[model samples]
Target: MEKAIFAMIASAVVGVFVYPKFIEFLESKGSKQEVNEFAPDAFKEKKKTVTFGGAVFVAVPIIVMVILNGFTLNRDLFLLIMVYGSYALIGFVDDYKIVTEGKNDGISAKTKMAAQLGLSVVFYAVYILTGGDNMLSIPFLKTPINLGIFYLPLVMFMLSGASNAVNLTDGMDGLAGGTSLIAFIPFAYYAYKVGNFGVLLFILAIIGGLIAFLFFNRKPARIFMGDVGSLALGAALAAVAIVLGKEVILVVVAGVFVFETLCVIIQKISWKLRKKRIFRFTPIHYSFTLNGWDEADVVNMFYGIGLVCMVIGFVLLSLS
Candidate 1:
């Protein structure tokens, strides 16, 4: 508990203190954001803000952990950091392309998906080799569902989908950060309950870093986390879930992310099959904005719902 508290405090301090300097560095380097053309028109005001600010917060906790636990590096901690850091690297590349190219276009979708899949394979293989379970725990149930051979594909899908879900949820200021912060509370608790201090500390550190990022990323934001932050956060959440054997509960704790991804997927399938659109915007949060809710309101609503889901997930996990 002491270590966890220290990790959180150190990470939060790093995020809060380092972010200002990072933003100045980004601006000096001309690493500013370009609004996505497909984004809702209301977001035009955010153009040219410094981006990839998430990269700082993401690396801080990892560096802290490495310094603290270097001699005792465990498989779970190593895997968690490696998988998340690798995904952040991918997102960094995407952000670099967006900033330098002066457009939203990054790597091709196919290439990005391929990279995610390959990374997922490596993560799962390492997890299995390190004696992680092939069974999944279902919420509100006692028996573990064994996936046997199918666990590989399921793990890959969960990792990949988890990362993309946050990417889709990053459409609005404080949307992804707030939602993810709420989701991590219960996940960190779950890790603590399961005796996985490594995972617990890592998650608590992330929560702290996210809180600091939200300080700058709130309404009328001064900087953006870009794809780099979102993807890394999503991957970290997935890692926590996997380590705790509670991946299924993520669908509940991260309800907002699931909803946003579902909105996009449903919109895509409907448009391709029936030649029509579903919502005013695919993420559904922007749909709220389109329906007269302020961006702050949308972010608050997501935080509220996410807290409810997080609590429910905690209760269910406790019961099981």
Candidate 2:
């Protein structure tokens, strides 16, 4: 508990102080955001502003974690940090490419997927070597069912799915970060209750970092998290869920992410099947935008929906 509090304080202080300066630095370096062609007109004027600020938020927690937890490499912590850092690096490259080239295009989809898959393979190998069980916990059932050798592919899917889910959810300022903070609250409690103090501290640190980032990430965000923050956050969440043996519940608790991803999938499938698009735009949030809703309104609505889903998840978890 003491470690958690200390980490929170440290992360918050560092994040708040460092973020503005980082934004300025990026601006000076010509590292600004390029508005996507598919993005709303409202966002166009804000183009060339700083982005990828989530790197700072993520970094603070990791530094705090290492400093306080010491240098010993626990399997879980090692995987969490490695996956988080790797995804962040991938995002950084993408963001840097976009900013430097003055185009929306970053890394190609095929290349990015190849990189993510490679990282997933490494993560699974580490898990197996660390004596991590391949059994997945059923939400309602207390027992875990082993998938044996199939777990490798499953882990890869989980990691990749989570990464995309979060990337999809990053359509609005503070939307993904705020909702993720809410989701992390439960995971933090679960870790604490399960006597996983290290994981608890990690979650708490992330919560702190997100809270600090929210100061600038709210509506009309000063800096966007972009893919850097989203992918890293998603990967971290996956690692935590895997370690806690609560991967199934994560889908319920993070229903907002799932819904966002589903909207994209549904839209794509509908377009492919009927040669007609379902929504004005994919990811559902842009649907709201196309319907004349403000970004803040859509974000707030998602946050409300996230709260309800989280409550249900908590109730079900308690009952189970």
Q: Report lDDT per candidate.
A: 0.84, 0.83
Which one wins on TM-score? Answer: 1
Q: In angstroms, how far off is 105's CA in candidate 1?
A: 0.2
The global Cα lDDT (0 to 1) of model 2 is: 0.83
Clashing pairs in 2: none
Q: 37, model 2: CA deviation in Å?
A: 5.4
TM-score, model 2 to reference: 0.96
- Each prediction's RMSD over C-alphas, in Å, is 1.3, 1.4
Model 2, span 142-164: residue lDDT tens: 68899998988878877888887
The TM-score obtained by model 1 is 0.96
Off by over 4 Å in 2: 36-38
Measured on C-alpha atoms, candidate 1 has an lDDT of 0.84
The candidate that wins on lDDT is 1
Q: What is the lDDT of residue 129 in candidate 2?
A: 90
lDDT of 2 at 22: 91
